[model samples]
Target: MQTFVTEAVDWPDTAPALRERVRALVAEHGERDQVRRANSWTKPDPQFSRKLGKAGLLGMTWPKEYGGHERSQLERYVAIEELLAAGAPVGAHWIADRQSGPLLLRLGNEELKRRWVPAIARGEAFACIGLSEPGSGSDLASVRTAARRDGDGWVLDGQKVWTTGAHVSHFMIALVRTEAGSERQKGLSQLVVPMDTPGVTVKPIVDLTGAHEFNEVFFDQVRLPGSALLGTEGEGWKQATAELSLERSGPERYLSSMVLFLELVRHASVHRNPELDMLVGRLAAEAWTLRLMSASVAAKLARGEDPALEATMVKDLGNSYEQAIPQLVQAAVDFGSPDNEVLRAVCFYLLQVSPSFSLRGGTREIVKGIIARGLGLR
Candidate 1:
C-alpha cells in the first residue's frame, strides 16, 4: 500500500500580516448572520468581493501586468485561510480567483488573458465553471455540450446544470466537444463563453434552504470568437483535472461548517459538559490535522510539484470531517433548550446543507476512486 505522506509546511513570513489584514477586512465588512456565515464561501456579496479586489486580496498570485499582486502562493493561501475561517462572504469572486483565473494565466491565449484576467483581478468580472450537466452528474466525460467551428469563430449549443453562481457570473469556462462524434474525454475543448451572449440563458435552482446558489444555464447558438478558446483544443480534460486539483484542496473544502463549530464551542463554554468538551477536543484535533495536510499540499504546489493525489485525499477527508460536524454537534447538544437557540439554528442549517459537502468539487465516490487508483488499489 502507498502511504499518504505528511510534511511540515514552511509558511511565508508575510502570513501573519496577511492574516491580520484579512481578519480586519472581514471584521469590518463580513457577513453578520450566523446561519449565513456557516457556508459563507457560497454566499455572494459582490460589494464585499469588490472590496477584496481593491484591497489587493483578489488574484494575489498572478502577474502585475494582469492586475494581480504577484504575491507568493502561500501568501494567497494565508489570505484565503483567514477569510474562510472567519466566514467571510467570498463567493462572488471565489471561483474566478481560485481556479479560473489561475487556469487562464497558465494556458489562456494573449487575447483571452488580457481581456478577462484584469477584470477578474479588479473584481469587476466573475466566472462559473460549466462541468456538470442534467444527466452527467460527476461524469464529466459524458458531457453533451458541444461547440462547432464557424468561419472565424464557433457556435455553442447545450445546457449546463448545477453551475454555482451562474446567474451572477460574467462568463463560464465550459468543457465542450469541439470535434464531431468525439467519444468520452477525447476531442474536448474549454471555451470562454460570456454569460451575456445573445443566445445564453440562466435559470435559478433553489435548494431546500431557499438559496439561489446554483443555476441551469443554456447556450443556444451562442457565437464566440476564435479567441474564446481557453487553451489547446482537445486538451480540456487534462486542463480541467488540473483545475480540480486547485478546487479540491482549498480551505473552503473543510471550513464550510466552521461557524457551526464555533457556535458549538460557544455553547460548550457556557454549558460546560464532559461530552461537549471531548467532542470539541476531537473536532479541533481533526481541524488542525486537516489544516496541516492542506498546507502541506499547498507547499508542494508552491515547489512546482503536482500533488493531485494528495489533494484528492485532502478533499475526501475534509469533506467527511466537515459533513460530520453538524451531526456530531446535534447529537451532543440539547437543541430543544431555549438557551441553545443559536447553536441549534447553526446546527440545523448545516445539517440541511452538509450533505452537499461531499457532492461539490466531486462526489465522495469519485474522489475515493481517484485515491484508490493513485494507491494502485483499483
Candidate 2:
C-alpha cells in the first residue's frame, strides 16, 4: 500500500526578497533588443543566460564548492518561478541547472563534477539530455545508443531526436546501452559527451514555431574516455529515471503558456467581456492549483525524496493547462483586430505550438500510466 500526500509547505519568508530580485532581472532583459520574447525560457539566448548566471540565479541549490550560491531549494524554485513567469530566455542554462548539474552532483565522479559543474553554475556552459532516440520516445529503456568499451575508453553509435537545445549545448548527458547482449533497462549508462567529438553530427529540427530549437543528433563511431561515464556502468537506468523525475516536475511544464495567459488577464482588466472574464477566471484557478501541486513537489525534491508519481501527476495536469490556454484564448478573444497586439501575438504563437505541449516532457498517456502504477493500479 502507498499513500501520496502533497501537503502545503510554507514557503520561506525570504521568498519575497528573492522574487523581487528575479523580477528586476527579468524586467531588465525584457527591455533589451532581440530579447523581448513570448516564451522566453524555451528559446536559447546565451547572452541572457550569462546575465542570469552572473546574477547568481543559475544554480541556487548547488553548494558553494561548485561555484554556486549555496542557497536553499525553495529559493531556487522561487527564482525559477519568476523566470518562467517572465518568460526569461533560460533555455541555455535550463537543462544544466534543472537536472544536468544536479545529476553530476549526485552521481558524477570528482573529475566530472570539477570539469563541468563550475561552468554550468556560471552559465558559461550548456547541457542537454540524450534520452530520446529516433525510435524511442518516452520509452527511455529502449534506447539503442551503444557505448562499447574500447580499452581505456569507449565507442558510441546511435541517434537521438527531439533533443531541445542540442545544437547550442556544449555537452549532453546521454543515456546509452553499455552492456552487450543486454536488453531494456539492464545495461544502460549515463555518459558525459562533448558535442565537438568526432563522428558526432547535429541536425536541427524546425518545430511548428518555426524555430530551430529541437535537434536530431547522430553518433557514428564516436570515441570517448572511460571517465565519461557519469556513474557506475549498468546503473544508468536508475540514474536516468531519477533525472526524468526532475524534468517532469518543474515550473516550465505549467508555465509554457503563462505569458499568453497573463496577457489575456491583462487584456481582460482593460477590455472585459463576460465570456472572456469567465474563461480567464477558470484558467487562473487551474494555474493556481497546478502551482501549489508543483511547489509541493519542489519541496519534496529539496528533501531528496523520489516523487516520480507525484511529478508525473503535476506534469500531466500542468501540461493540459498549457495546451488549453491558446485554444481557450483563441475562442474567447476577437482575433480580427485585438485590443492588445502584444497579447494577441503571444496568444497566437502559443496556440501554434501548444499542441506539442503534451508531447514535450512526457505524453499525457505515459504520465497517466505512471500515476496508475503509483496507486498500484497498473
As a TM-score, model 1 comes out at: 0.99
TM-score of 2: 0.96
lDDT of candidate 1 over 205-261, digit per residue (tens) = 999988899999999999999999989999988898888988889989889998889
Q: Which candidate wins on TM-score?
A: 1
Residue 364 displacement in candidate 1 (angstroms): 0.3
Give the per-residue lDDT of model 2 (tens digit) for 1-378: 435585877798999999999989888774332223555667888988888889899888888999889888899999998888887778888999999999999889898999899899888899988989988987878899899999999999999999999999999999999998899999999999999999999999998767888899999999999899998899999888877899897888888888788778888898868998899889989988899999999999889898888899889988888888888888888878746677777777877777888888778888888898788895
Stretches of candidate 1 exceeding 4 Å from the true structure: none
- Evaluate residue 200 in candidate 2 and report its C-alpha lDDT on the 0 to 100 scale: 92
Superposed by TM-score, candidate 2 places the C-alpha of residue 255 at a distance from the truth, in angstroms, of 0.9
TM-score of each: 0.99, 0.96
Per-residue lDDT value at 211 in model 1: 83
Model 1 lDDT-worst window of ten = 1-10
